[model samples]
Target: MDRYEGFREFVHGRQQALMRSAYLLTGDASQAEDLLQTVLMRTARHWHRLAGDGNPEAYVRRALINEHVSWRRRLRRRPETPTAHPPDRGRDRGDESLHRLALQEALMRLTPRQRAVLVLRYYEDRSVEETAALLGCSAGTVKSQTSHALGRLRVLAPELADLLNAVDPQEVPR
Candidate 1:
């Protein structure tokens, strides 16, 4: 466990999770693949620095978010030119028929910041404070954004309202 072997094991165990989160953040297969690739490369390079943090998974997740935010910022600045051909198809799209896909699509319709907050708070099961820390925002902002996101989600995907009923209001700090 002292050598690169430990890093290899960590990657093997968490790659799926990393990829899923990346996909959720990006809402595009190609971007998610690229996101995971860059994240892994940076994680490997800074493994020693992060391993000592005792919460490397959180560190890596924060890294993913930072990268996503950075990408969003860059995308905002860059001009998009139309392509002659469409992107390549056939990738691990997961079970597309699952009800989960509906939720994912609805999420993609949200603003990037709202989507990030929703994913961090709900999908990733992070606390408001934790999400705020990761996204570099205040707890109040997280709560308000979460409320707005949930409201939008309810309107965008009414079927998911049942799932919202199952979540105790107290669980998400007001």
Candidate 2:
């Protein structure tokens, strides 16, 4: 009973953070929900073993990330979001919502690893060392990946690049 109670508390405390990270990784709301559910289920199976650990959250997070990568590799294809032409440059209505959608679409176009790097480094506002640790890579790899992700974003969506430049880094939502 105590173990179950503790697990419940852990879920209540961490569900939002896990969901946010899952959404960033999957890029689709439904898929994100599924991903979180799967991770939670798997974690529950090892709850007894993990619960005694000082930082079970880290272990669960590592599982979440590894599972996400495994799923992508098994599928052998990127997510298949329907693409639509962006609004004409000449007729810019300057709609913030539209810009946000465009930015999201651009993000979805990125490879999973690139998207993960951006989400951890920018959206989550984790330090390079932290991001590298989470991704199981060196700090130098994180730096290079961040640089390349930014460049890819620029090329994939110039308008989004402008939007990114216009917003304060702090204003960027997690």
Top lDDT hit? 1
Question: Per-residue alpha-carbon lDDT of model 1 for 81-161, expressed as tens digits?
Answer: 989998774455565444476687788888888888988887888888999988888999998888888778888988777
Span of ten consecutive residues with least summed lDDT in model 1:
89-98
TM-scores of all candidate predictions against the true structure: 0.77, 0.78
State the lDDT at 73 in candidate 2: 87
| Model 2 spans > 4 angstroms off | 1-5, 77-94, 166-174
User: Which residue runs of candidate 1 sit more than 4 Å off their true CA positions?
Assistant: 1-5, 83-101, 164-166, 170-174
lDDT of each: 0.82, 0.77
lDDT of 2 by residue, 1-174 (tens): 554547778888999998988887886778888998898888888787888887878776777778888888877777656559754534355688677667777887777777888888778888888878888999888777767767777787887767556534442322
Tell me the deviation in Å of residue 149 in model 1.
Answer: 1.3
Candidate 1, residue 104: the lDDT equals 77
